[model samples]
Target: MTLKELLGIFERQGIKRIDPMGQKFDHNLHQAVAQIETPDAAAGTVVQVLQAGYTIHDRLLRPAMVGVAAGVMQQVNTSA
Candidate 1:
């Protein structure tokens, strides 16, 4: 069977996908694989999902692997 067909079977049985794209990054729900610079979203937000996670019965089966928006570092000057 095709991949979509196989997945459809599981989805029918209370298996759901955890696609957290464009959502704020949550450590409890998502696993940050890398941080990327993005102006489109706020810092610590999810930019892209490298791997999709899954859930069953509202419980986390696996954490979604994603790339989070990174904050730009600022330089500070100290004067005597």
Candidate 2:
């Protein structure tokens, strides 16, 4: 699911969604997980949580999807 969809889940659950990356949530996710150690990662699963202590206690909509060292998985080509 898309990041927006995840946020929707939180909204439905009466929870507040926090976007660390601000308006650029996707870009923020990429920046947050970059250069982090994620051993035994899957093909499209590299968004490893570095630390959770910093997170405020609240209902999470869902974890963000992050690309590996390369980049995110784009379903459609943006070069049009």
Candidate 3:
């Protein structure tokens, strides 16, 4: 059987994949691996998924390893 077939079988068994791309960062569902500063997306949004996560029924089997978008930091002059 192919990988797709295996995945289909798992889905039928109530194992589902968590898609985190473009979604808001949720500690319950995602594990932030890095904070990426980008203007393309809002801060706290999931910018990249390093590893796909799964869930069995309503229980989370693993959190999706992801990179969260961070707002560009503005340099504040401390010396006056």
Q: Which residue pairs overlap in candidate 3's backbone?
A: none
The candidate maximizing lDDT is 3
Query: Which digits, one per residue and each the tens of the lDDT, describe model 1 over residues 30-51?
Result: 9999999867788999999999
CA lDDT of each prediction against the hidden true structure: 0.89, 0.42, 0.96
Cα-lDDT of candidate 1: 0.89
Instruction: Name every residue pair that clashes in candidate 2.
Output: none
Q: Rank the candidates by lDDT, best first.
A: 3, 1, 2
Q: After superposition, how far is residue 12 of candidate 2 from its true place, in Å?
A: 0.4
lDDT by residue (1-80, candidate 2, tens digit) is: 99789767756766564433212324333334553333444333444434321122453435444334333345787796
User: Could you give me the TM-score of model 2 versus the true structure?
Assistant: 0.24
Per model, state how many residue pairs clash: 0, 0, 0
TM-score of 3: 0.89
Tens digits of per-residue lDDT, candidate 3, 44-68, equal 9999999999999979999999999
> What lDDT does model 2 reach?
0.42
Query: Between the candidate structures 2 and 3, which one is better when assessed by lDDT?
Result: 3
Off by over 4 Å in 2: 19-80
Best by TM-score: 3
Query: Which pairs clash inside model 1?
Result: none
